[model samples]
Target: MSLVMQENLEGKAEIPRIINDGKESVEDIISNRKQISEKQDELEEVDRELRDISNELKSYDLPEDVDVSSLESQRSEIEGRISEMRQEIGRVEHEIETLDEKVDEIDEKWREEAAKESKHRTMMRKLDFVEDAHEELTEIKQTILAQIRENTEENMNRYFNDLIWKDEDYTVELGEDYTVSVYGRHGDNKIGSLSAGEKQVLALSFMSALTKISGFNAPIVIDTPLGRISSKPKKRIAQNLPDYLMDTQITFLMTDEEYTDEVRAHLQNSVANEYLLDYSNEVTEVKGR
Candidate 1:
């Protein structure tokens, strides 16, 4: 599998290797990491055993009547045992610390891998969406083209009716531009040639048409929806938005000016829910597992 990178170079695709060593590599790393963790746990067990032995040694009140040398020898044996236990405990703790560091490193690597996987998944999902859109466009190719033709004609008549133009034809081109290319009667130019404001109108019109046709009754989340429009065009959008998004679920993410009280009041009639995120004074708690 390949990680999805937005900056896909000219030669970036990796050839599918017949013999995959990735699984083996992953197994090795996982095995090593697991071994370290297990060893650390075992070390903790040994430390507890040593502590118990030390406590037992202290609990035994040696008899005063016993031979001094014999008592010394017995105490020495216990001391030796305690010493060995302490050494073992130290060794286990060192190994545990080492394993802890190694586990941390493993986690860091997994984090990087997860991020790459997420990006790859996101890229694949996007491709799937585009392919679906393309398929949808393919299925309704003629219908959408006709709609575009009709809508474009209406917009041109309303906006550029008095302007001098060239080709006066607005025939819908089927599958030619994926329903995006608009051959203006002014010069038969593509929609790409349209002015900024015109492009905004076209985009809004296209979105309205798309959502209306798709029939997905979901909230519309708009981030800076009016970034590309002027006051006049924004007002026009405010007035004309209802024509397209009549009863459809919609959400608009906006800033102060974009979500002004007037704008909110205007959209409130169209939208049933609204929220404002003000981080001026907020607090959050963080904890670790």
Candidate 2:
């Protein structure tokens, strides 16, 4: 029993050492476990960071054969082109401003030209109106003159045929210049060949026609009407004159040589009254006959 006690005391002493040593070993094991847990947490963080980097790389989706250096070169070239484009835009804007100024100038010029054109158009319209009016007046004048000429021709022919003692048929034509042309048989002009008496008869006929067509009611007076005519033409004229101018008032002042017995006999039937003018002692006196 005493040996067993001694052995137990020794065992107890040895047990404390052993337990202390075991405590040291357990502390080491616990420290090593803490270090291992820290390493695992760090590994997990690294894995998460690697996954994020892989997802970023996948989003880029770069082809396997693409060169990073070439992409960088292309980026520099694109930047250079963008700089050139900006300069070109500035130049274009300046040109646009210049063109705007030119357009404004052109617009002002066009406005002035348009005003002139408007005035020209107004003048042209007035010219057209004047031309039309002139044409209308000319036409009316021509028509009136034509009517006057035709009436004068008819009356002259009637009076001439009545008084003329010629056996041939004669035609009297009034030229546009108011010259008298007498045509005889075979269309020959007889004015140059007519005797003084015949010409006087033609002049009397023309005068009578003109007076009738003059549209005046004034009395006609004549002196020496048949002075150049022969006795036969004078008698014939006196016979036809009163009848042709039946509606007109006419007076004849004649000398005794012109107022022959034969002319008086033909005109006395148509005379309503007679007057004589006598010039003696440089004074004129009118006496009723």
Candidate 3:
């Protein structure tokens, strides 16, 4: 997999492939995230007020030492304060309801605007939107996301199986927070537990699947394609990768470990041009392989 695909699987903190190559700049999407954050701040303020009211109501508890009948005047004062607090609480509760309604309205508008912009609505969703729409928009967003994830997973799994030359079965699930979970014979496999070579394979598979599904015919360039894998897998990859890519052009940046004699022999017929970089004390030179 490529760095871009790895970034997508890791989290949205790193930029992923831009599904919309339209005139919209990165600033536009970032602005959307910022707007969502500001709206969230507003909601938090309303929540704090509601919490304060609730705390005030709880504070009206009478002390165990106090006698209600003996302190009749004090009891009346307490009653009056309790009544006033209840009314204020009701008012604050109403504000919370109103704020929630407004947030829902804005969320709907944002979804509509994203659709109109021809951007991927799934990609446009922010964490605040997910939390705010917990009851209302969760189902709607899940339905859309499920469909896209299913297609992407199917493509990704197929490509991974073929490229990795593995006989076993595994599943790929695209999760929330831009996480990619791999399920193998053990039920669930953590990406962190995988070796560097395995990570590379997974990333390549995902990138290939994304490109295929997106209907993009652009050439692919992979840096350090087989840097970490053991000998057996490297041989298999070198032999199979060109065929897997088919007509799509692929460029690989490789060190001596990756572009070994075995790899060169496997790619003998497919090779169009090759180069060797020679580095010395001051300068470097590129020579034909």
Ordered by lDDT, highest first, the candidates read 2, 3, 1
Off by over 4 Å in 2: 1-101, 246-249, 265-273
**Segments of candidate 3 deviating more than 4 angstroms:** 1-148, 165-167, 176-178
lDDT for residue 195 in candidate 1, whole number 0-100: 66
lDDT of model 1 at position 273: 52
TM-score of 3: 0.46
Tell me, by TM-score, which candidate is best.
Answer: 2
Candidate structures ordered by TM-score, highest first? 2, 3, 1
In terms of lDDT, the poorest run of 10 residues in model 1 is: 10-19
Candidate 2 local distance difference test against the native: 0.74
lDDT of 3 by residue, 1-289 (tens): 6443344454432122232322133334455455555555655565565556557546878678756455555445555555565565555555555555655655555455545443333433553366678856778888877777777788777767666756777777776554777778888775667778878888987887677666667888899989878878888878767766666777788998888899989988887888888998888998996
> lDDT for model 3, on a 0 to 1 scale?
0.67
* lDDT scores in order: 0.57, 0.74, 0.67
- Give per-residue lDDT, candidate 3, residue 151: 79
Of 2 and 3, the candidate ahead on lDDT is: 2
Please give the lDDT score at residue 121 for candidate 3.
34
lDDT of 2 by residue, 43-119 (tens): 55555655664575568978889675675565555555555545554555555555556546555555554555555
